[model samples]
Target: MALDKHSDTFSLQRRNQNGSTAPLTNWGFRNETDPLTDVLLGSPAHLFHRATSSLSRKHLREAPCNIQVAQAQHAELVSTYKHFNVNVHMLEPEPELTMQVYSRDSSVMTPYGAFITAMSQWWRRGENYAAIRAYEKLGIPIYDMVTAGTFEGGDFNVIEEGCVLIGCGDARTNEPGARQVAGWFEAEGWEVRLAFIDEYYVHIDLMVVPIAEKLTAVCLACTEPGIVEWLEAKGHEIIDVPFPQTMALGCNLMSLGNDKVIAPTSSTYLIDQLRARGFEVAAVETAEISKTGGGIHCMAQALRRGD
Candidate 1:
């Protein structure tokens, strides 16, 4: 069950005239589609709002306390995103996910395109539909969906050009989902790795992220041991995400290609660590945005890359 070595993928999100989310794939256009390099990563419109959990009823009475800070953090995030040369895309807030939306977590970006996911968390299911609509508008082809397993975009990280990693735990993306991803990539002649961890590390990108070609930012404290060894085997130089900064999302760095990245304010150690490792790092204030267990890498999904 292997695909040809040279096949690619397509995305399913679409766009209206205003660059907003368009739920219809009616256009059916494929050629001349914009690449991920042309798209900019964007932040979710609301604050303290989470789009991927079953905590729908839990936030009714208890509200988020850092709304103001979250807004400021989002604005700073927007500014930071521009420095990366991204064309930001936004999703209109829907109450189905309790208004806490991590738009980037809605789907996984692949070499071919974006693959829609079946969220194991009930509150996050609607996010898939929202993302699908956006991809459809963007004219990205759809690789497929997580038919047998529950998958989330946050659990997926394209560690390298030919290697992909899938993390399963906390009911985000499960075992079946990881296997499915492996199967798909293997079919395409790509290496796939699965890291099954606790709910605390829900997404692989939360702890480990690629800053450049072979460099990664990791929090050894929570990062699984075997994966660490495997990375070393693959020739990856790991920059440990400081425990204190990791808690504040220092590990959540986003690669703007090359050796450049965007990190949050609280992770000073990460800033110094990345800088020492030869990365051009830009630090932003994200105290408000991190409350939902996501950061720079989590907020934006790279739709396409020059592979």
Candidate 2:
């Protein structure tokens, strides 16, 4: 359906004039009432990373010259997306670029639309605008702009049905960013809590992710007692990620509806834990992708949730 000229709320699926549902797959509608219904998260490979960086003097490290490895990882990522029956959109890299774009800011989804964030890293700053243009080109609405607050989409997490947990730290996202999102969620009558983790934690999703309704994946190493208590208060069952596995991004698994997860093949323990929970798990090797310090959850964001 066509969207209003001035509004960002547009439909990617065709609409039925006679009050019937559109034919854009059973789970493809962007439901305004259920904001999580049509949102999606993705990582751009355009920028990988450097071992260390400082605004003053930044060190640059090029991804392995082996195009084969990059292609292989992309292929794996594409298959993962297809496995979940979602669309996969890749961003082409511009020449003379530094750093890889594995963590393309954060993936922000709202009832009105999806707003991809700008990269906090100076070299990757342009990425946010690029993501915005892409969503606009695809007819996705912009819920809000994170201009004053530099936030990455990775830190945003929905712990319970209506409550969201956002992290503020590191160079990626800060207090201003958390407050920015808090304002937006508050405007919608949703509950948001700001969790202050050390900079080593990066994004909230890095340490915590919801694998299924009432089920959460967390790195026992990075999770705080208070956070655990909070999750318990919300009646969420925790699937712990062992320290080694967590470092390998084992906790970064993504949920595919009920009792199923998309995880990295390298993370044996995490996959086993998921299976123990009766989840049908799919494991793909993400060595190259994980080099940038994120796994399935970091590489992808869920835009839709099924009831």
Candidate 3:
């Protein structure tokens, strides 16, 4: 299929043409908290790796991930996605990159198409090419590629239709790359907010997450006060997740939209808080897998999210 020049954005639907369902030509997403229709998950076949990030390195030095246990945990994550009726797509394995299981860092999904990322770590850079191959195989459009500086998809969060919050710690995503992303979104009429987080936190998703239309979970101890105030001013109810749990990836829960969320079972505090708010929660155990430095949100990339 060719690019639809007349259409403003690519469609994710497999349209029924004539008597058969036509192949998908494009896939896109606008926000994080939407009914997840399609997602990209990483394979466990190549997930065995030593600690790369500062956070994971500490624990990895003490005790590295048990490959078998990590693989089982990963399968549970995939099963959870399937149980929710989400269309799961896997990236082809890159044997040399063990941290590739955190597929969220490979690329950012936008309403226009995919923004292929530039990984900061040398060993993990190959994941970008794998993401490109996945997009091509799925027939998704490539909106842009970050060549200015290092940028990872985990730092790009679509908070609303016309608003995005990006994090730059100079490690995962640098100022140059963040500026480039901001410019692209601004040109498309989006109000982009830049959050400069501590490098230890890795990505903004680790500090702040949107779970519903006007509800967000934030790690108050680490998040900037201005960002919290801004979110509150926008009518977003902030749920403060404890610092200890935040370190455990508590704030990294995935929103399935319509007041539904998928979280890690180890994050009891977040699970209880989400439940108290009457949101449906699907909690999966990621104790073994998370030792590699990410949570459920980092493991899956949304391809299509419903408004």
Candidate 4:
């Protein structure tokens, strides 16, 4: 249904309370790789390096992020999106929300509407509210808010049109949160699978992400064998990314569909593989900014993917 943008009673909950919610006509997507037309990104103007995760803490302790360079890199990422003819929307910058640059952590755009996620970290919780306001401004109704427990958008991975793979790392996304989300989708007749991962990995997107329909990128060393088997059973072609590169967010990429992808320059392995497959790859340097804890996929929220 089209949203009445001027209405004061603009519904915030677009999802059905009992399931069978109709997909939004103007916004949201059925899957990750579907010719992305609109995307949501957060501003890095106020980004700051923080001990958000084990990887981030390690980077902070070893070599602090150069904020200026990170900001510059983010600009390049935005430019890359523009080059692909994707409409980019930015969330208003808030100084206190230093890690806001990772837009995928706050909300997930689903077929029904936007799912406002509950952040795990105390400092990041405010991002949920920020995300709500941003969606309101964009005329996108919310599906629902994660209330059972803390859940981040990175854990909500849509494997296909009516299927999703949720991740529970206990740190960023807990079992309760994962179960709550899984139940919602299950009731909606979606094939939902929960992947319990180690906290060190932070989120499942780091090790497993969809590149295109029936094609996925995975780090076999870190992902559970069952998950790998599950993908294979569904006829998904897995491109294994080495453990070392996976840790550097090599598996984390945004597929623009129609054989196009936006990847991190650090992910040389994945980029090379995609290029070899005749996919147009736009490699942007994100190593400096990633020290704050996220890759290309984590930094962008797909607003509208299929037509």
Give lDDT for model 3. 0.83
Candidate 2 vs candidate 3, TM-score winner: 3
Better of 1 and 4 by TM-score: 4
Candidate 2: tens digits of C-alpha lDDT, residues 1-307:
6454234444432222222222222332222112222324343444445442221121224443233574477577667667666565544455423333443354465434555565676766765656666565666655556766778877777676557788887567877777877776665556788888877667777778887767788887888888888888888888888877776677777666646677888878878877877888888877665665566766554445555
Q: Clashing residue pairs in candidate 4, if any?
A: none
The stretch of ten residues in a row with the least summed lDDT in candidate 2 is 28-37
Worst 10 residues of 3 by lDDT: 14-23
Measured by TM-score, the strongest candidate is: 4
Q: Name the better of 2 and 3 by lDDT.
A: 3
| Tens-digit lDDT track of model 4 for 142-204 | 888889998999999999889999999999999998999899999899999999999999999
Q: Which number leads on lDDT?
A: 4
lDDT of 1 by residue, 8-77 (tens): 3233322111222222222211211122254324434544455333222233235543667776777787
Question: Model 3 over residues 137-254: C-alpha lDDT tens digits?
Answer: 8877667788799999889987777799999999889999999888877766679999999899999999898888888889999999999999999999988999988888989989
Give the Cα lDDT of each candidate: 0.65, 0.61, 0.83, 0.91
Candidate ranking (TM-score, best to worst): 4, 3, 1, 2
TM-scores for all candidates: the values are 0.81, 0.79, 0.92, 0.96
Cα deviation at 167, candidate 3, in Å, is: 0.3
Shift of residue 22 alpha carbon in model 2, Å: 20
Candidate 1 weakest ten by summed lDDT: 26-35
